[model samples]
Target: MGKDFRAIFWKDIRMLVSGKFFLLAMGALALYTLYVNFGYVRLVELSMYKVCLWDPQGICVDGSLLLQRASSREELDRMLLEDPDGVGIDLSRGKAEFLLYRSTPQVERYLEDYARSLLRPQEDFKAEVLGAFTTEEKQRREITCELLFFELSAVGFLGIAAVLFREKGMGVLRVHACLPVRGRLFLLSKLAVFLLSDLCFAILLTLLNVGVGPGLAILPDVLVETVILSLFMALIGLCCALFLQDFRQFTMIYLVIAVFVATPVFLSANTSVKAGWILFHPFYHLYMGMKNAFFGTPGESFFYYAGAAVGIGLLYMLTAAAFSREMRDAPGGLRYAGKDVEKREEG
Candidate 1:
């Protein structure tokens, strides 16, 4: 069993190499690392809201350095005009009055609060710090987690499906039915190959973007989440490839999963966008599980792990059924039969 599994595993590795799966994964890693280090972190830095003050009598003292002084009322108006988002203070009458371009009530309230915080910088208006991560480190981890989720859910899914589709196209699966190896070994081999690839990817992605020391501390949890997600997605891809008639059908389903299904999870998790329905979405929990792992806060619920284990088991059974059906119904069976006839005639 071990020898046969090893052979099947190496065969799948060769198939992946021929399809450039490793190369594409390395390319994705490079692209994500570059974006995190050079683009996302710099662009997402927390810039304070611009606050313009026109204190003609200089009544306000010890204001935050974030405040921009407006020499006159006209200059303050001009500043607010140039920067529509900027909050202006008209202290010319010796009493503070907030001024700004009209906006939604919620935004106006937030702008007022921000301006007030600047006025009283000495007060503890900031939210309590939870972790010791710096602003840049936080941004790095956030984007890294997002990228890793995308890679596992979308890219890894596609990779496995593509490999299986290629094998199907080349009549390799039909040939497997006549081999001495058990059918389940074929499925397990593919799962093992992709699972290992994904784990390696998760490790490198974490260590490279999240820093070696910090990423190492959280890697065990992260890899645990990675294993669950990787196996689930690979089995899904396998079942899809086996059951669908062709790549075109699979592409349509893939788009629906990647766009409609995954989009809501991202919005609800990353942005302030809220949806009560998202709580029931399985992928949302999977994404959050991976995210919490990166942040060093693994989910403590036994039910979550139990549900994941049950889900994977069901998917494996479904994949095995699909594999058997495909093998029995494949057109390659006839071609192999004809080859057998030719060999018998030569004998």
Candidate 2:
């Protein structure tokens, strides 16, 4: 069993190399690191909200550096009209008045709180420290977590499926059926290869974006989460590839997974686009786990691990059953006459 596993593992690794999966991962690592360092981190570090002020009477002190003085009320109105997202302050009266375009009552309330907070920068307000990580560290962890989630859920998931489709196209699965190795182990080898690749990516991504010190500190937990997500995604990839007719079908399914499935996971996780049901989204939990690990926080509660374990077990069982069925249906590439595709000759 050990030898068989090793052989299959090495074969899968070679296949991955042949497919240039490693090169793609390296490219993704560099792109993500560059974006984090040069683009995303800097974009996040910029001012939270642009404040346009029309305070002619000097009623409000210029507490925020982001606050820009408008020449008159007409100017402030024009600015608000041009940039509806920009919060406008009309303090022509002695009392400071916050003006904003009509929006949801909840959003309006949030904008009001934000605008008030900006106006009182010198107030002695103490923030409850959630973790030892600084603002920049938090931002790094955030973008890193999001990118890692995307890599596994979309890229890595499709990678395994694509590899399997190639084997199917070449009819290699037909040969594997008669091999001494158990069908599950055959699947396991592929899963192991993908899991290993994803783990290495996780390590480098954390270190590169989150910095060495913080990344190393949370490496263990991050790896645990990575293993969980990797296994689930790889198995799912196998299931889809084995069952789906061809790559064309898989492409459509891939669209659903990447766009529809992952879209809400990101929107609900990052922004205030509240969806009450995200509490039950598995990817949300996984994403949060990755994010928490980067920030040196514990996200693996009993429920979290329990759900992950159950999910992995279920997916493995399903993949094994599907794989066995696939092998039993066609044990060899040999077929007689036009009934089977394997035995046709003289083409």
Candidate 3:
């Protein structure tokens, strides 16, 4: 069993190489690392909310360096007009008055608090230190988590499917049925290869973007989530490749999953867009599981792990069934090849 599995694993690796899957993965890694290091980190460092102060009386003393001084109330209005998200403070009324386009009550309150905090820079307001991550470290972990989730969910999903489709075209799966190996072993080999590839990716991505120490601290939890998500996506890709008539059909399914399924999860998780239905979405939990792991707060719920285990088990069974069907429906030439092997053995 071990020997057969090893052979199949090596064969799958070669097939992936021929398809240039690893090259594409490496390219994605490079792109993500560059964006995180050069683009995202710097961009996030730009002030979250630009505070424009229009205090002509100079009543405010020792204000935060973050404040953008406005010569006149009109200039403050113009600044807010240019950047609608910017917070504007008008002290023309002798008392500080907050002015901005109205947003949600929660957001308005947050902006007001932030602006008020800036006014009293000299006050020593001691706040409890919850986590050790600095602003830059937190941003790095955030973008890294997002990129890793995308890599596993979308890129890894496509890689396995593409490899499987190539094998289907080459009639490799047909020969598997004729060989003296369990049908599950072929699927297992593919899963093993892709799983390891994804885990390595997670490690590198985390280490590169989140720093060596912080990334290492969270790697164990991150890897656990990666394993579950990797296996889940790989099995889904395998089932799709096996059951779909052709790559064109698979492309349509891929688009549907990428657009409808994954997009909603991302929006609901990352953006202010909240959907009541997102809680029921399985991928959302998977995404959050990964995000939480990056933050070093793995979900402690037994049900989450249990459900993931069940889902993976069910997917594996489904993939195994699909593989058996594909092998049974092999082309006549492959059937002939199998017969020749049997005849040679009998002789």
Candidate 4:
């Protein structure tokens, strides 16, 4: 059994290598590391929004050093027109009137407070830190968590499916139907391979982006969450590939999942957008679990792990049933699903 599993593992690894899975993973890791360390953090630091003022009567005495002065009301209008995100100050009525684009309530409140603070710098507002991370650590953990979620949900899902689809195209999976190894092992082997790859990706990504000591401190818990997420996503990819007709349909379905399903999870998790249903969104918990693991605060409730296990089990069973059906109903005299694809393509 062990030997059979190892053979499948090696075979899948070769397939993944030919598919350039490892290369893609490395490229993504390097790209994300560079982006978090060099780009995103600095961008956050400079997010003190540009304040534009058109105060002809000089009703506002204290102007901020960060403020950009405007000569006329038209100039202020032009600034706000060109950069709607920039806060505009209109003092034509002898009082500072803020003109800015409509945003979320939280953002609007922040912008209004910021504009008022700039006009009166002596009115200092103090804040108390609730969390213990430095800015760099917070950003590192944040970006790392998001990248891991993306890799597992998007990249890792595609990688496993691509390998399985290759097997399906070449009729290799059909051959496995006649093999002595258990049917589940075939699926398990692919999951195992991708799981290892994702875990490796998680480790290096954490270390490179979040600093060695901090990342290592949380590595064990991170790997635990990684395993849960990898299994869940790999099972989903397997079921999707097994049940979907072809890569074209798979592409459409993936877009639905990636854009619609995943986007809201990101928005609700990272932003202040409150959704009453986010608590029921499974991926949101998975994302938060990975994030908490990175921060050494595993906030996974009882329902998260339980729900994850049930989901994985259901997906696995569905994939197994679909796998059996595909084998049993393979086109007559043809070994694989895509044996006649070339003829169809030519037509």
lDDT of each: 0.89, 0.83, 0.87, 0.84
Model 1 C-alpha lDDT per residue in residues 1-347, reported as the tens digit of each score: 99999999999999999899999999999999988888888776676568999998988797888889999989999999988878998888988799978565647877887787787677865424578888887787788899999999999999999888877766778878889989999999999999999999999999999999999999999999999999999999999999887788999999999999999999999866768999999999999998899888896489989999999999999999999988877864455457768889999
Clashes of 2: 0
Highest-scoring model, lDDT: 1
For model 4, the local distance difference test gives: 0.84
Alpha-carbon runs more than 4 Å astray in model 3: 53-73, 90-97, 102-106, 119-130, 331-347
Please give the ranking of all candidate structures by lDDT, highest first, separated by commas: 1, 3, 4, 2
Cα-based TM-score, every candidate:
0.82, 0.84, 0.84, 0.78
lDDT (tens digit, per residue) of candidate 4 on 1-347: 99999998898899989989899899999999889989988777634577898888877776667778899988988888887888998888887788886467767878877887787776673223458998778888888899889989998988887777767777766677787888878888998899989989999998988889988999999999999999999988988888876677889989999999999999998987868998888888888888889889997888778888888888889999988887766432253444577667889
Tell me the lDDT of model 4 at 192: 87
Kindly indicate the candidate among 1 and 2 with the higher lDDT. Answer: 1
RMSD of each: 4.8, 3.7, 5.4, 4.6
Candidate 2 clash pair list: none
Error of model 4, residue 118, in angstroms? 11
By TM-score, rank the candidates, best first: 2, 3, 1, 4
Tell me the tens digit of each residue's lDDT in model 3 across 1-347.
99999999998899889888889889999999999999999876645788899999998878888889999988899999999887899988888899876466547877887787787766753223468888888889889999998899888998899888777766777877888999888999999999999999999999989999888999999999999999999999999998887788989999999999999999988877778999999999999999899999886489899999999999999998888999998543454467768889999
